[model samples]
Target: MSFYHNRLLEQDYYPVVRFYYYKEWEGFNMPNHSHEAIEIMYCLSGSCLIEVDGTTHKLKKGQFIFIDGDVPHRLFVEPGKSCRMSNIEFHFEELETVFPSFRHLVSEHEALRMLTESPKSYLLFHDSSDVFQCLNALILELDRKEDESVFTEQLLLGQLFIRMAELAAKQQNDTSEQHVYIQKSIEYMHQNYDRDIRVKDVADAVHLHPGYLHRIFKKAMGTSVNGYLINHRITKAKELLKRTNITITEIPHYIGMNSQQYFSTIFRQQTGSTPKQYRRESRYTDSRTVRSEHFKQQAK
Candidate 1:
């Protein structure tokens, strides 16, 4: 008996799933190695470290790293710490297939294009989407190897790629948005620092809720909104004291404070000097500079 099959045509793009596994490690280390397949290591619990090309990245719970093909890397779990992770390794090959390839998908999805075209050898991301579920499903299907499993596996893999790409893109967008909001808040503070402005006024200018603005501002600026405002006022007061012969009592009003005593207390706390003492010291330094210049001109 003889068997006959149709000839396979060349495909522009097709993904080949090499292998995948879920593993737990404790104080386990893998030496640097490279493979032809791209890989993803997703942490489910605890944490681990991934060293790639001399840079070490801490992969905590819910985070994952996507490493490109032929990139040398290794995983290390510290002593007394354990990490559970799901990993999938895959590569592309040219073959006949009905499914969409990553190249083709990139044309339709800007996020996917960025993911594939990024110059970084590896990308780390925190997963908040269905990426884990899809990856687990693909692993299960691959292990089954039952009839019709191939189609299901391909579909799940495609979903996984799209999900991861979207997650990375969302993270980038969120970071960019936060940066813009922070810059706007700082600009608002600088512009209105000489007024009796409250945190709510700054929030209102940025169209953000006061509490939300406070959280992000502190996170980005390392100080609260009110703290930044007070610091700015003190800075302006210092400049006025040093460069101008402004009255010590009027410095508070110039910097938006009505109570001279309160201003003095805060200034002392920040600069370790009372306003009067600072003014006196500044004048003494100026007189010394003038005398030195006169001596130099006389010598010439």
Candidate 2:
């Protein structure tokens, strides 16, 4: 017998924005997950719960949360209690015609930058009376479904996001700026996981010596440079092992892992399952789940 636990609503679609609006209910909990589209939820008039990547936040009325595509998130509602929120899902596009800032944001690594820095996820109405009122109106428009043109709603939502971005940018005081070099190095390793991504190359890109860079990166990110690189490669390798039909033997070298044994070793270190076990247990991945996520973008 197969048991599917609580999971995110699964669907397939391309890079475009969509809108959802409603009141929430109690005992409403969402399972943890990552997706290709960044998600936004606006809380109207009710109290509920929001969980993102294991962190919990108490959601009150007139608040919104922005979740990055890579983040694993969940939701919860109290039983018999009426709770509601508007959900908007959208993909980040780089096409100028599709999205004006898509190209620059993509090239500049803006998305990741925001995830690590921005605190605009939760828009509290009390904090800004005017913005909160506007958000409420937007939520109302979203709920009516009277608009014949779907794109019209999405454009309005995009405007809301633009305003949020402007405020968050001004308020951002990146104490983490000291770790910028380390973040840059980490992004590089992630991008070249399929090839020989030497620490020297990353260090060179960040303008530091390999030895110095390794120490700084480990201290800042809490994982050794080599270990972190291996971790990402193995994680990716595992995702492919279960999600795709690619043979295990062929998966390693493609992910910068030299041997199946070594790949299996790190796989065990990070994930309790061996590569073989991972593949077997991957029944949960199924075609339905695979269809929702695209190949994660690499840092350029």
Candidate 3:
């Protein structure tokens, strides 16, 4: 799978499953958005951070994040780092006929219940070899293009769904305590990103030593504490730059960066555009002068 090719299902397919492989992707900023399809995102090489309903899920290699349909989510990448991940989107209704028990389990199991009921709910699994193999095989089959064997595709899809259900059933006992610590730290970052926070601050919040936290955060998150923090802040900065009339100079301050120069440099490094450049060319704004004046006067 290359950078921009999408292997989508045809209209007559039993189920619509799309395979996407993005290679060495520079932080592609996707805003809070939603679709009617459930999405399973697998980190293939470099790490990626995804925010679903404002809670950030940091996924390194071999980790999966299951997002329910109609969930608002966004993906983030570290500045100057290339992230490669697989996004597999499939509609739940497609499985109604094939996997009736799976849907029953989703409604019956508490863990799976939250995933379907709550828009903000998601399931995360780490270091699952079976899940990884299933996803990898699906990608390979889809990439072949000529191997349009509906039977083979259906078999693989059944296997993948079975693996996912098995994992969901046993996730309660399979979750790692260390991974929980990392999640806590990430949640702390998400909640307090606007403050003058540091890695030590996050470590302290999670009750881990700074050095030990750095090691685990990198292993779990595939980026340093500062790297995640900066990317998180940059994400917020991007939101402000587009949706608000706030001047570029004031945008960084709103997102906790004190220096506009540093903010612009980091913003450009992550997004390939300066704050002003981003603001000047956003669909969020049709005309800038009116909004800019309104924001500036409101700030005053």
* Highest TM-score scorer: 1
Q: Against the true structure, what is each candidate's TM-score?
A: 0.75, 0.40, 0.47
Q: Which 10-residue window in model 3 sums to the lowest lDDT?
A: 1-10
lDDT of 3 by residue, 1-300 (tens): 111112211122244575456455676776789877778888888887889977898888888888776778998887876677777876622332443333444445565454334333567877469988887898787788585445556667657766776776576453476788888988999999888888999999989899998987797789998999999999998788778777777777777788878988899999998777787787446566778988999999
Better of 1 and 3 by TM-score: 1
lDDT of 1 by residue, 1-300 (tens): 000001101224555688888899999989889888888999999999999978999999888998887889999999999999999888765655577655566667777777766657788998884888888888888888867534566678778888988998998898789889989988998988777789999999989999999898898889998998899999999899999977989888888888898999999999999988888898899999999999999999
TM-score of 1: 0.75
Judge candidate 2 at residue 224 and give its lDDT: 81
Clashing pairs in 1: none
Q: Relative to the unseen true structure, what is the Cα RMSD of model 2? A: 19.1
Q: Ranking under TM-score, best-scoring first? A: 1, 3, 2
Best by lDDT: 1
